[model samples]
Target chain A: MVERTEKRHTEKMKKKQAAHDKIMAGKTAEKGLLIVHTGKGKGKTTAALGMVVRAIGHGKKVGVVQFVKGAMATGEKAVFDAFPGNIEFKPMGEGFTWDTQDRARDIAVARGAWDEVKRMIEDPSYDMVLADELNIVLRYDYLPLEEVLPVLTGRAPMKHVIVTGRNAPEALVAEADLVTEMTLVKHPFREQGVKAQPGIEY
Target chain B: MVERTEKRHTEKMKKKQAAHDKIMAGKTAEKGLLIVHTGKGKGKTTAALGMVVRAIGHGKKVGVVQFVKGAMATGEKAVFDAFPGNIEFKPMGEGFTWDTQDRARDIAVARGAWDEVKRMIEDPSYDMVLADELNIVLRYDYLPLEEVLPVLTGRAPMKHVIVTGRNAPEALVAEADLVTEMTLVKHPFREQGVKAQPGIEY
Candidate 1:
């Protein structure tokens, strides 16, 4: 009788313990990582913005630095307006590089923007960072990939960083923890002959 | 002098004309929107994986669903482990409500698993929706937000939805118009004797 009782008791304990193991395990993790959203597709900036909202929803602090495509009043501005003090929205305006006749001025703006954004990446306080449209900078060679990578990866406070734009360099892809390539199957501009719109395009 | 002036005016007028309007003018948009991530995160079978990723990205397509997270074997599995797949990861068992509990059964297995996840957030083919915390399902709810959202949204076309969780949500977030969230902040677990090692509490 004792032997039988002992066996039953052990089985019950095993069952109980299995139940306990599931939730208690895997609850801890490091603080930060990187996600790169790039490709020949649209929505790179939009994806970064989406992440910004998701981070904020979970009660995280986030910053957005637009490396290109900064004309003004994009919808993301509405989010910035709604949140007010919580979010820092910085738009690095170059509008369209091809249209900028002044090469010196264009280079100046690119340089100025990178210096500002690089400073932000190095700061450990930000919970999440969005380097919007920064891909173009790398693609256009406005910034050196090697110089930017270590700073972005190292000092991020274990916080999250998102870099978005088209034509991300192969080197950048290799370094990213998570990388997404947006492929454009079709776009409306091809049919309408309409120029880019405000709020939407900018 | 008058004839010369007229000719000069005509020449200038006929020289060239170009117009540019951004998309924000409400000209074009992604036809259908939804998110699917077979990547990683804490919970699965807890929410529909598509709704959140999309709405947060673009403002199109809506009404989709998933309970539980993507399939396991990723970073998310480390975080969520064997959390519930029922009632969208009910914290009642091991919900991480306060963050201090052995919480194996309460955290891992749920009552119905896919049976339960299949019930909530039905059909993301409609319009914008939110599949909050669906990853818990994977622990028990095991519904694979990836397999579900992709086929559904791909078939629906021209709608938007979002899916939220860690570990990729990749396949979905990749095809998603937008994807992002959860960089992690001052979590309370660190104060406790918690460490996010793999399998057990990643």
Candidate 2:
């Protein structure tokens, strides 16, 4: 009975491998991707930062502009600062929307951060640009979508850009080459009154 | 008009900050988290690796065991190798289930990796343990869920264990303190025939 099961499994895997190879063979195109991470869960920014780390590992230069989380100190800032030559990490926001509570100031801050993002995207030296929480500012209309979309879609062909936050606009999703929505399944803060900790949430 | 706006913003922020402080004050519990990153979209392992990087930044020791991606050379492996004192990165699987085609060998490989994970969990020196793609092995029954859950749930009070992959077991989900499901929004591989590139997928 075991011998028969082994034979069946081998045959099934052989067929599956053949199919996988065929699909892989057809994927020949290579270019920079316009990636978006949105939705109500965690890991959107964390995953984008992971890509930043990967780029750094490959000796590629990266630019990071945080749009909505500049009031507090983050562990990423301290870590990325260690690689001054490879990464230009900028946390440009004053705080969250509720904390700021000033529309004009929020718009000014978003514009400054967006301007930095535009510079990084335009510069050929940066291999990857992470617009951290850009979607949040966009969602709040602190920055105009009309101006932002053009610069993103018209970026250099070989430069990757990552935009992260919740409630990404439909138009941005339509334009992005890759998009992932993080759905919150369970949260300790909501259910068990646990606070966010260092080396985890930051 | 500008002065009025500023005045209103200041008052609103003051009230918001007080409320925020109260909420934070209630959250005094500090303990390790059982985090699960699962779903059909991208960034499951990527985000987990980001957390690993964060832990490293904080000078914490970490153990990473890859369960189903040993065949390919990954950028993360090369990167994590630079921090020998901090990260013990191990990719143990021969390949994916379809690539291996042997259930017995798969199970043995998974058991070996799980043993490593258990060791890391029990060791006091390790601050965080990442079971990368363990969910895939669990889904395939290469490792018994009954044996895995106890080691994970009963881990040390301050040791963080991160499990990443798609289709996490329902029981595992129930036990996780933080769970994020990466949902597929748009994929270039399916629509534009773009292959996974270095610094992005690996």
Candidate 3:
């Protein structure tokens, strides 16, 4: 029994060490500015969600904009809406950039949504703002990097924003307060050829 | 658009004010116990979970004895099994408390399982201990509170425990570091006159 206790405790200590390392990965993230999540990894949004739930538990108000995220239905969206009118979530209806079919309409939606998201960045009302899948928008040039940069830098005096997508731009990452390139460690999908699990993935 | 900005900022300030008030509620809970959970909250388990998660985020190793929880194949139990693994979840299957209806059999499971939970408290390995739904056992008199009190108070040097169930005793409340009474506030089954939703309610 004592040996069982010691083994798991050692594992626990190793995890604590990893968490500490992740914390120290970026110095500017301490003051909170921007988070850039990019790479061929599956969980940029999941990592952002871990942070969102942590902030909410700490009594923070959050605003979220999901570019190319509107399919009009998802279990997560349902759960997000169930949070008694405190948390705010808005999804740009263009859904996936590739799936939208009309490039011009997608760009128009992204541009229009950018105006609202840009304002939220500078407004002190949101404790955290998650611009989900915006990296893809930037990658495809649906929104200019010039327009994105100012909001990233001059965010609401209190608001912190996280940008998640694969293939995020180099300049954006260079400017980000915290940049985490999620490396593909080991994913169940790859091993088993299983599709994304709804609750776990989306 | 300008009005929207002002409104968002105003809401932010109000949320900050509400946050200040909620901060005190956590302090009220700090008589030295924490509970952390990372599973679906279909039943009474979610309330038990929020405390466990809050406790561990503050750096607590928690021990849990899940009497009726181990026998079933639930998504929550799988996730709990995957948690940092420092969380000791011994799922001794006795089925629902009333179903077994045998005092001798019930007492043996309680004795065997609570023995490990008690060991966690005495050895200083646990910061918070949750005997999830042990209150039901207490109500049935399968385990004597006298057998529990010494382990609870003597372990006061390093641990805090949460016992959750439907009909908690008045004496247990007095002994608890924090007691939360989850009154079934407008349950879905009663409201919709439908069966409990799978994974949302047991």
Give the best candidate by lDDT.
Answer: 2
Better of 1 and 2 by TM-score: 2
Task: Give the runs in model 1 whose Cα sits over 4 Å from its true position.
Answer: A1-28, A71-73, A185-202, B1-202
* TM-score of chain A, predicted model 2, versus the true chain A, to 2 decimals: 0.96
B1-202 in candidate 1: lDDT tens per residue? 8567556544543442123333335444454434433233222222232123323223323332333322332422221222222112222223331222222432333333333333333455334444534444433323556555644365445433344455544445555554433222122243333444221122
Candidate 3 residue-wise lDDT, A77-137, digit = tens: 5434434344677777565644444556767988876776786777776778888888888
User: What overall lDDT, based on C-alpha atoms, would model 2 receive against the true structure?
Assistant: 0.89
TM-score of each: 0.51, 0.95, 0.46
Q: After superposition, which runs of candidate 3 have C-alpha atoms over 4 Å from their true positions? A: A1-30, A188-191, B1-202
Cα lDDT of model 2 by residue, B72-184, tens digit: 34567556766679888888888888998888898999999999999999999999999999999899888889999999999999889999999999999999999999999
Model 2 has a clash total of 0
lDDT of all the models against the reference?
Answer: 0.49, 0.89, 0.58
- Give the docking tier of candidate 3: incorrect
Report the alpha-carbon TM-score of model 2 versus the true structure. Answer: 0.95
Best by DockQ: 2
The local lDDT score (0 to 100) that residue A169 gets in candidate 3 is 86
| RMSD in order of candidates | 12.0, 2.1, 21.0
